[model samples]
Structures are given as structure tokens and as C-alpha cells.
Target: MLSPRAGAPPPSCPRAHSTYALAQLHAALAKSGLSTGSATPATAAAAARACARLGHLRAGRAVHGASAKLALLPASALLPNALLHMYASCPGDHYHLQLARLLFDTMPARDAASYNILLTALAVGGHVDEALELFEDMEDAGMAPNEVTVVAVLAACADVGDMDLGRKVHSYAKRQGYCGNVLVCNAAIDMYVKCGCVDAARAVFDGMGDRTTVVTRSSMICGHAMHGEGDKALELFAAMRRQGVRPNGVTFVGLLHACSHMGLVDEGRAFFESMEKDHGIAPAIEHYGCMVDLLSRAGRLHEALEFINGMPMEPNSIVWGALLGGARLHRNVEVGEEAIQRLAVLDPGNDGYYVVLSNIYADAGRWEDVARVRRGMKLRGVKKTRGWSTVSVDGTVHEFTAGDCAHPQATAICDTLDGLLDEARRRGYVPDTSVVLLDMDDAEKERVLARHSEKLAVAFGLMTTPPGTTLRVMKNLRVCRDCHAVMKLISEIAGREIVVRDRNRFHCFKNGVCSCRDYW
Candidate 1:
């Protein structure tokens, strides 16, 4: 599939000098008029706006300082809003966010634009919880949110997979008539997709009908692809083409991702070749990585390795990661070793790669090698990433780590898990202890497996939800083989549809069968 080529660095903005000069003139005018204190808020606001537009943080700070010296900031909300906008507009460093927060909190009176500026900044800065809190405060203040506010809050909800908040914001958008706005609709689509509610995302996409953009279609396609609905993804692409909507690099990436997940090798190859020939889009590193993932996932390790060797550009960590994942899947120790060697150089401090290699060795029953890899990780000071899972019940989000007992409902969850495992065993469910990776007895391994983060989340779901309610859980790591097997058994035993979004993709279990068909 087509990938984005890294274009040359953008030419320096020629108007930067002009913009700075304009800001300087505004500052000079404001300072000259400061003697009489003739309401220089407008002048200072103009200077700040100019600097914000050009992303001149230093100049913006200077303007702020000059305005403060002239005592122009408290005259009106304009100058402070302009200063907040400048800090939010600047792209680098935490200093901008800190300063923005300080200014926002200290503002004598705030407006909707003021709240929107800091909310967008906090969300974009990855302070999602803080952003959501600010949004709540905005609501408490009787502020009617606009499209930007809705979009920003929806985005923050998506980052944390806060489906309850996301759904509320979606309703709010509809009530506020923001649903007609394309940007708002796109953000809604993205939030639903990321939250693993592909059906909800599709509903939004279909409603957008004539308003669909490349981003909207691409989001839906990738959503379907990631949910393992490859056929639907392809059908959507076909419809896109029929409707004369030109696909971009991201669309092809989703197409390739669909192919990779579904093992559609020939179709994937055709798409990859057509990316450059028909679409006139050069194959970027992401496209190459997708191709490698496709080939490697389909048990074509030799071909994948050959393809990597012949790449026009140097293969990156993602390219190697694809091969490594394939090798781990197919138990190709040699290929896995090779990929890890390259990965060691490319990303020495990453724990996931080392863990993957260690798992590969463990799968082959190479205990000494596994121990060696573990030692190497210790020497390099790389700690394995802790895995966790979150499940939302009745609008409350509950989090759990492996063997976690911190929740107030821990006793009930454990009891529920015990009962499920007992019933699962009666239904011919045998724990697959190979995934433990630790040198322990089968009994110990089984106990460890039973206490996995996903199991705890699933047990909690069982305890809290009504019968037949679909259990949706989000995990920070891939689900282990034993858990996958157990989930299928539990689905049949409890007559529940279980949906899990793991690090890799979504797994929907119903009637003792996973949507992935045990492939992932």
C-alpha cells in the first residue's frame, strides 16, 4: 500500500520577518501610548496574534512581557486570550503548556475562547485527564461549548478510551447541531473507532454520507480493518472508488493492514504495486513495513527477509518489528534472532523487542538462551512493560493489573473468576501454560494465567453487568493464548459476547469462537 514519503524540510517562512516586524511595531505603538494608558489591549492583542500565527514563541513572550509592563493585560480579556492562544499555538516544550495553564488560571475573567484554547492545548499536550477536568469545570461554569470544545473533549475521551464520556460528547454534539460540522463528525468517528466501537463509528460514517472526506473514509476503513473485518474494509474501499473519492496514502495503509490481518497476500501485493503505478504515490517506509508484515505474517519469512534486503531505503524498526512478530508466530528462531539483532541497534532501550525475542526463544524451549536474553536486558537496564486492562461498567472505568487486588470489588472478582475457570475446565478448557515464559510448574503457571489482567477485567465485567451484556475490555498488551482460549469458553458458558481491544487489534468472542479465529 502507498506510504507517505518524507518531504524535504519546509522552506523557512519568508513572511516570518514581516510578521516579527509587525509585532515589533505593535509593541512600540503600545509602549508609546502607555504614558497616557490609552487602552492598549487592542495593540498588545494584535502583537500576540501575529507571533502566535508565526509560532514565534520568543516574540510572543516578549509581547506578553511588554503588555504586562504597560499594564494592558487586565483591561480586557482580549490580550490574555491572545497570550493564551500564542502559548497553545507554539509546538515545543512543556514550558508553553505550563505558562498557558498559569495564565489561564490567573485570568480575572474567562470567555469561551479562553476555555477552548487551554482545553485544546491540554488535550493535544497529552494531559487528557487534566483536559477532561477542565471541560467539566467549563460545564460547571454554565459555558455553552462550541464545535472546537466538543471536538477537543471528544479527542481527550478517545485517548483514554473513555467511552462513557465519548458517548456523552457525541450526544452533546448532536444536540448542539455540531454533528453537521465535518470536523466534529470526523473527530467523533475517530473517537469511536479508537474506543473499539466499530459499529458506532460506522453509524457516524454512514450518516456523514455526502460529507465524507478522505479522513472520514480512511478512519472507517482502518477501523474495520483493525477489527478484523477485512472484507468490509475492502468493500468500503471499492465503494469509495466508485463514488470517485480519491484515496490517499493513509487509505492504502489501511487497505494493506486489512490484507495483512486477513492473510490476503496476492491482493496485498497488487495494492502495493498499484500504490506507485496507479496512484502515483511513492512507497514510504510505512508501506514497506506493511508489505513486510503481510509477507512475514503469511509464513513467507524468506521472501520477507529478501524484500527487506532489497528495500530502496533503509528498513526501520517497524519493518524489523513486523518480521520479528512473524518469526515469533511461526517459531522461526533464526529469523527472530536476526530481526532482534537489528532491533538492538535501532532501539536499544525498548523492552518490547527484548521481550519478544525472549518469548521466541522460550517457545522453542531454549531455556539457556531465554535466560541469556533476560540477563542482557538486565545489564542494559530495560524493564519489561507492565500489562494492564480497563473495563467500563455503568459509566465507571475500572483498571486492573496482573494479579491486581487493589479494587474494592477484588474479592467478588476473584470469586467470579474461580467459578468461571471451574466451569471452563468442565467444558474441556485446559490452560495453555506455554505463554507464561517463566520456568514454573504447570500448576503455578495456570494460577498465574488465571490472574491475568484480562481475566480480572472479564471477571469484573461478569460480576457487574447483567446477563447477555457484551463485555468490552481494553488491554495494554496482546492477550495471551490461554486467555484467548478461556475467553471463547467463557463466551459459550455464559452466553456473552466479549469484545477486547488489545495492543495488536480487536478480538470479539461469541458462542465459543473468536472473531480473529485464533490468528492473532
Candidate 2:
């Protein structure tokens, strides 16, 4: 227990009790070297607190070590908890979790506060499952979970997409009377959203007793956009505005993403402009990417190029990639080549730009230009990014490459894909072989495009998952245009939902329509 007078200061040292106490303690610690080890725990604790306030991880560790050596620490529970918090707030280091766990385990009798510190350490480190396991251990040890514990556990559940675990945690929070806490409620909303339980997320958002923060609103908007509910997302944005909660950068990102998904180009443009005028939030690179995607999807390639040119900051690889991609979509080979030139200047060693430029020339039937780009790539020593996809099934991530057939079940997987392709073709699916950049004959091009990693992943997903179950896949590269079209048809033929998160963003394919609305 902290003495009631601990936070107070002697009248003679009134300045020491002010908010600047941590700063003052830091200055005092500088005068007293660690080797001297002359400072008491109370003095060291003050210094650690100051370092934590300044976000100085190195200084805080030194003070913590000094305090342990001096034996000046009060054997009180609050002091240790405060010290543990100082360690937990440092940047992502495994040592922080190790130190926090040690402190929690060594405490004479663990309390809710001690568990809170350990739980937070696990959650921030992305050890979400471990955090939830500790939460159960905390309860089994007879410590009641507090608001902080609920928040941390919910965050963990969100990270792992464990909706069942999240709901159980939610029920526990309600039983413990911690559900009323605003922070816990906000985290619950976030967890629900991340778990793809959009309706549940909305319920949490609507049930909040207090005014929702910008982060909560942003999460809800993101959830709606991800689930392809653009109208609902816009409604929430409007409601947030009506409640006088000003949107921030994150909020605008969600709003813009919703507009992009629905192909609401006019609305997207207005929101992009309003980011600065209405919210005074400057557009970041991601925001610029969204604008370009919106313009390009709307068939305004020249306008998209103009937008890129007018940006106050230089565009990065993502911006250039989007420009090259848009020009290819519109068959504007000249514009695509210009974007590739800029991309080459910006990222001299990136092979993706070279590949994209070659594909553009191939689409335009300019074999000589394709050959020249290939030669330039060879001279510059840039290697193309290989297509790869990974699918998490039964908690195991399985990787596959283009045309890879090395898995134990390779025969079954390929046969299943062939069957799915036949079914898709019977339903009017045609393999778009134009996306293949090879300068070979039509038969070779068709064969190369059919073996793309995404298609293989989809084929594996179809064979493994139960019929009608949604299959989620992740890819390191953007989904090729042909792969995108094939997936749309595959979803209908297989009667399953497929969610793919590529290098750019999420694409949900269901009933032959992508979340990106053919714009991406």
C-alpha cells in the first residue's frame, strides 16, 4: 500500500510534488552515478517514473537496476506495481515481458494489478494466445479479473481473431461488473471488428454509455468497410459527426476505404479534400494511394496522374505501383511506361517495376519494348518478386509457389483445382491469359497464368475447407488481374466465400463480386 502522504511533498520542497517531479528526479539521478548506487528506492522510483515519462528505455533500466541494488524500495504492493508499469511501457523488447512475469510470479500474493501488468506485456508483444492463457491462469489462481485485465484479454482475442474466446471474455467481463468500463467496451468493439463479427461490433458501439472516442468510431467504420457495408460505414461517420466527435486521420482512412470499396468516386473525392479542410488532418501516403485507386477505378487515369503530381510530398513505391497498375488497367501503355520510369528512378533495384512495365508492353503486343525492359532489368541486376501464398489451416500455415507441386497431396490438390476450373468454365468462366507477361505462344501463356500462387491457394482452400465455409488466404504480392477474375468465378462455382489479404488490402469475394468492385 502507498502511504497517503507518499504522493505529497514536504512544504519546504513543494516543487517536488508537481508534475515536473519526474524531470527533477532525472536531473538528480544524472548527478548520482549508478556505480555510486547512493540513491534510495523512493528516489530511484521517481527517476524511473521520469524516464518512462520521457520514453527513455535505457535510463529507466539503469534506475531500476540501481533501486534493486540499494534495497531502498518500499516493500509495498503499489510501489512494485508502479515499477512494473515502468518496465512494461518500454518499447517492444522480450526483456520487458520477462521482467514483468518475474515480478508478478515473485510477488508474495498476486493481485489483480500484478496480473494486469503481465497481461498487457503479452498483448503488446503479439503473444495473444499466451496472454489469454495467462488470463485463465489468473482466474484459476483466485484473482478476480479487473477492467484492465478484460481490456488486455479482449485485445489479445482481437489479435488472434478468436471470436469464441472474445465472446467468452466479454461474458466474463460482464459477470465481473467490468463491462461498464469505457476502455473495456472500446476494446470489445475492436475485438469484435477484428474477428469479423461486424454486427457484434456495432452492438458494442451502440451500447456505449459514454461518448465514443475517435478510435472506437474508426474501428467500427473499418469493420463495416471490410464486410462490404459501405452504407453502414457512412452512416456511422455521419453519426460521429452529429455527435461532435471530430474525425482524425484514422477515421478518414476508414471512411475513404468505404467509399473506395463501393466505387463512390464523387464521395471519395469530397472526403479526400475534406480531410484537410474539415478535419485539418494531412493526407498520408496511404490516403494518397486510396485517392489514386478511386480515380483510376473510375477510369480517370489523367486525373489520377494529376493528383499524384499535385501531392506536396514525393510519391513512394505504393503510389507509383498504383499508377502503373491503373495505366495497365486502362491500356494506356505510354502512361504506364512513364510511371515505370519514375518507379525505376525512385527504387533502382526493385524488380516489380520492371515486371509491371514488361507486362504493360506485353498487353499492348509490343514484343520489342518487352524485350528491351527485360534487358534493362538484366543489366541492373534486379530480380522479380516471386509469387507466394500461405494459408492457415488448423493453426498451421502452408506455403505454395507458382506451379509448385511438391506437397504430399500435390496430386489431389491439382485434380481438385482442375475440377473447380471445369465447373467455373461450365458457368461461363474464361481464363484471361493476357495477364501473363511471357513472350511465348498462347498455349504457354495460358499454362503460366493458370499456376499462379493465389489459384493454387484457392484450390487448396477448396479441397481442405468444408463446403460453404469461407476460406481466407494471404498473399505477399498483389493478386494478378486474371487471378482476381478467376477468384470471382471460383467463389460462385464453389459456393464459398473467399477473403484474400494481398500486399495492398483485403478483398472479399462472394457470389462473383469482389469487395474492391473491380477497381483494384
Find the candidate with the highest TM-score and give its number: 1
Give the number of the best model, judged by lDDT.
1
lDDT of 2 by residue, 1-520 (tens): 1111334332321323454654455465665444465655555556666555554555555666666676644455654666677767742667766776776676665677877877877887777777988887887888777777788889888766666678888988878878678788888998877665667889988887456788888888987876677899999999888889988888877888788778799999999999888788899998998888777766688898999999989898878877887787788897897788888888889887787788778888898999999889889988788889876565555789999898788888888888877887788877777887776788787778778888888899888878887776778788888888889999988888887767656678989998777766
Per-model TM values vs. the true structure: 0.93, 0.74
Model 2 quality (TM-score): 0.74
Lowest summed-lDDT stretch of 10 residues in model 1? 1-10
What's model 2's overall lDDT?
Answer: 0.76
The regions of model 2 sitting more than 4 angstroms off are: 1-85, 92-179, 182-200, 207-211, 241-245, 273-288, 312-318, 347-354, 367-387, 394-399, 404-409, 440-451
Question: Which regions in candidate 1 have their CA more than 4 angstroms from the true location?
Answer: 1-39, 66-72
Clashes of 2: 0
